[model samples]
Target chain A: MILPPPEPQTRRQLLRGAAARTASAALAAAAAPGAGGVAPASAAVAVPAASATIDRLQRLVRVELLLEYCYRQVLSSTILRPDARRAIAPFEGHVEAHVAALEARLAARGATLPPGPASVSQANRFLARRRVGGRLGHLRGDQDALRLLLSMEQVVIGAHFVALLKLSEPALVELSAQIMATGAQHDAVLRLLLPPHKLGSAAPYGLVQGVQ
Target chain B: MVGDGGGASRRALLGAAAVAGLALSGCGATAAPASTRPAPAVAERDLALLLAALELERRTVAAYVAGLPLLPRALRGTVQQFLSEELEHTGELISLVRSVGGRVPARPNSFQLGHPSDAAGVLALVHELESAQIATYLSTIPQLSPGPVRAAVASILTVDAQHVSLIRLQQGQAPVPSAFVTGAE
Candidate 1:
């Protein structure tokens, strides 16, 4: 289940953290776990940097397909209004571009791209776990649809940024940043639509930008 | 959860980002107004990168802000909050550029792919903007040392994904269309 993020940190609480010694200690205390406790950094999915490029690409491809499926399902299903479909249509094209571009890049490296989202069948299984109701979920209304998209945006923003950091190719890193920037633009819109309580009380509630 | 020293701390970026994420859920009744700082001139290289990034962000902020107003009331919050997040990001970029001695341009380039109508127009704009943004970070990420600059870029890169989702969500599109998402540097 998608649990609510930890309680918003108070100004004094955050200041106390700044005085701490290390990233671990700070994150640990911040995420102390119970009522009013923060979820430690260790609890969040660590961006796995141990894998080979090919492996990373494979996993990313899976995520991309999954995201595409979620959007398509939400759009095509009875969830959103008919007028909203017009707005959602371009996203499919965007994904198609991402897929084609990645496939071409992979092909040049002699590594075949995994099948596009269309060819991926288990996408529903992957997304169902993430959907609000934990199934091939349906939005209760426009608000729910918007919220679902916002949640997905957090993940997307994290992915491209992660890709930029993890990828070995300098050029690819640049490309990932470009892809990432677009994601940023989309995210801004999602954020503006949210309510006061939902916006977390942190700098990047979406992803952890590893420090040097 | 940021402290009063939030403005002075490294974690300030982290604090505002939470608001960025929430601007969508109809949450965030009180976004502490960031103390305004005027944009100052930045280094040449830094300026280019910052402007590239800023222009891209401004375009997004404008698109959503402009679009949200056009959306029906039932769907108002989604687009509105999205724009607010962009505004927050715009603040980040503006401050960064100024701190680096760069000047943020007065106006952003277009997000429109020629005309305003048609799906292709929107997709083309998305493709162009996404490509440009990716290029902006790509060109800059390698040059930045393993420090704040790097951290900033990484942070912003992640925010990009949020933008991608809204673009996709609008047309019944997917959040991600491809499988290759990592760079093993």
Candidate 2:
């Protein structure tokens, strides 16, 4: 008999499955007594916590990849002015750096690296989940492009903020915060480059909670 | 016969409990002290870090107020906006500190904000102060327990980083010079 192809799995489904496995392992370890007839706290808490960190890291890597895809598209477009291009070229490099760091983290955790958007449809789906779909096609001019980029940066910042709340490891938390700060910088710079060029518009609020 | 079985099971349970107690004691002796332990619940370290952040914010507020007069007319509005936002940060941090049962330090009567003769000097000072604030938040975020407090500090750090970028732009320098904002100049 011939076998059918495996069904495609969403990122959320993969994460959920991993989390369930981790919890099951933790429970098993907790239920089985050790030589001392007791289960250590680490056995019950550490495994699940580490698994949670990995899950958050994986999610963030996906976010970074989406950003990389968006940045590459904008950089190749003719919508940006020469000056604007000069300023934004560095931002793409920044996204790449973020991806590299996050990828290394996932590798350390022995998790598979997630893929970025390989087509326009995939990119739109990513944006749609964030409630900002079809924005890529709306960049009719430099102003429109800058606005979209600003919104994307805010999304990145918010992603990191949410990840920080869930990450249990100190090093991962620090890394996420560092990356989030850079996203905010990108947002501020894009605001300055936008129309009505005012410094006040760059950082309108003290709290950088992002567009969410 | 039932009485005999019940006694035997009770003895086995007692033996297991004794073994568990010994294991716990051994683990406690090898582990770090309770004072330095990192718990999910709020601890003294969290309170201390919050207070430190609050102090830095208070100083920033004072610096902005004192340096406002030194800034050029064109830059005053932007600096004023930053000052207002900094004040808001101070308020949020104060509330956080209090929520965690920390003693809020009294604001200093005045900060010795260096005398900057021109807009350049004032901008430079503000840039330095903002960078330091970013550094404090970066260092504090990892140390803080995973919760709304850590998230709030990260949010503030991002805004401070943005301030540094804007200040650099006003200083005729490249904005966002680095991929990683590590709080380093």
Candidate 3:
């Protein structure tokens, strides 16, 4: 269940605590000798540009198919509660809608729709890595299923963010931006469902630029 | 959200350049005046986009200003958080305008937010505002040239979309509004 909203006094106290913490961090940073001498730098991995508009759309179509396929597999599991199934239904439906839109766009270009990946038979194959022991079935629990879905949403958001830059056609780029927005919404809601200790906030710090 | 303080002077020069361009176009000499020549389509398009984004962000900031007082204390924090983001967005857009040869736009004289009687009204208003912002950003992305400008707009657009989801959840509605976001306009 969603928690009740904090009281006004509680809100004020929380703000004060946050301010104090910020001040302490600032002071600590200032007092650290020679710390300012070192400069921090970060780099962004630029998403590769598609060869052509059709090529980009075709790649995105494959992504939607993969998402839909994963959602269908999770829905078929017996462990998911009825309410959980109900919630997931619309998400699956939305992915299908995305597939349709993408396919339509591809058809207009006389491009063939890309097939779904042959390897995405189960959730573990998608979620787990060999470096971390082995694949475990995350769909065995309702919470885990939600987490998987959240990760997919983030992946989609990152893809569209890149596509917006690569796409040459104005209308296609617009469509990508719109869909990316929805994907972000999905990310927010899914993040909220995870336990407070697991996922801290509804939104991320800056724009989510993830591609994988 | 802090700007580097150089944009104001640049924007002033841009405004002067625009005015000078217009004035030169009025001359009735035999040859076409320098101002009569159209600015590059790419540059003009970028300028228009920056202006539109500026207007959207400013109006949204105003929406929060008008709507927050009516909301319950519990809901105010969420709105405030969103407001801060919007303010950051406005700052970014202002810098972008100067970067793209556009002058600072006149701030909105008034926002069109309707009266809200309660917390629900405030949230509903927020939902509408966020949806509009999301749509605008989506539609605008295609028009932007591929580079930092487009990337910046997309980044802000994604955040607005997230805001829509959060607002829907508060209303006990499904988080996903639709399968695909369709930016009609």
Candidate 4:
């Protein structure tokens, strides 16, 4: 006789439970009559069109792949100091993990995972365009690599924020938020590495702003 | 909308409805069926989530205050920075709550945070608090109305996550201790 599949892992089960609790609390409050200052839990909220969401995820995947490649380049380049290379390794590993996680998510949904690094040519071109002055973007020194990484982290964070707003699935929203937080940490670490003259006070804003 | 009566029953009903809806939406699908009908003009659910989150931020700020004294002098600045960010988050949340005609809930002068003896204990408290906040924001975002407000919540969460990483790093742990930050419940 065929055996049944194993139960969901504890973490996944807990996430589902939390999502249930949150939904129950919010929906009940919405459904209640004349409840506090809450607006009526009127009609269903809108989510992004299914096609649009898929396309956005695909774009994010491509961007992340490009980031992984850049991180690899910086780590391998002789120009980077030994200490800097060591510092960047964990971050690079995180990017690789992000790409894998995102790919698995897409595959689970029956969506095509865009083929490896070549798919991010547009992102590469964009970074090329972003190169300060006439210097090569990806071939620069430690500070330049850090700047480049900072810019990329900002882009990823912004994309995740937009994705979080549009995604209807609690799991995906949670995933996006988690990655966005990691990206912010990476940005802060990189900023601290730069010279004080180049960087202003750390933690510059009370609220971190994303693309509108 | 906030409710004062029959909360348990209403929550049970809502929970059942949500489970049923999820079943119909399929395993991988994240949203309800597309409707040509216009979306709701007002976001009642978003407002409720914001109000709840605002209260959590207040508690978080208080926790930081309680933990600060226990932290080493070198790390005190870090906790202070986190406290400031939490306060800023509170200010923004207040605006969102007010925008939806919700009343600002009262914040007590002090929130009860367990006493921690040493630096490690203080860090542990902060780690636990940030993890809870991260989970709260993660779950709440999907239920929120899709717009700038949701984006703002996402941004705040990103910063909170950053704070957690900083704390972990200070304690000689990996800045990113997990591949996936949620699912911690």
Clash count for each candidate, listed in order shown:
81, 0, 0, 0
Q: What's the i-RMS of each model?
A: 6.4, 0.8, 2.3, 2.7
Q: What is the TM-score ranking, best to worst? A: 2, 4, 3, 1
Model 3 C-alpha lDDT per residue in residues A112-163, reported as the tens digit of each score? 5676656544434544421112222444577777767777776777777777
Cα lDDT of model 4 by residue, B1-185, tens digit: 11222122334333433443333222111121211223223276677788778767766766566555556576676677777677767766766666666677655444445555456765787788787888888888767765566667777787777777677767777666565566251
Clashing pairs in 2: none
Q: What share of the true interface contacts does candidate 1 keep?
A: 0.25
Pairs in steric clash, model 3: none
True contacts kept of each: 0.25, 0.88, 0.70, 0.56
Task: State residue B33's C-alpha deviation in candidate 3, in Å.
Answer: 43
Q: Give the distance in Å from residue B114's predicted Cα in candidate 4 to where it truly belongs.
A: 0.9
Chain A superposition TM-score, candidate 1: 0.57
What's the distance in Å from true for residue A52, model 1?
2.2
- List candidate 4 segments past 4 Å from native: A1-48, A108-110, A115-124, A129-138, A196-202, A210-212, B1-42, B183-185
TM-score of every model versus the real structure: 0.45, 0.78, 0.68, 0.69
- Higher-TM-score candidate among 2 and 3? 2
CA shift at A106, candidate 3, in angstroms? 2.3
Deviation of model 1 at A186, angstroms? 2.7
lDDT of 3: 0.63
Ranked candidates, highest lDDT first: 2, 4, 3, 1
| TM-score of structure candidate 1 | 0.45
> Candidate 4 falls in which docking quality class?
acceptable
- Model 2 over residues B1-185: C-alpha lDDT tens digits? 11221222333333433443333322211231221323234556788887788778766766666555556678889987887777667766666665556677655544555555456766877888888888898888998874767887787788889889988988888888988998775
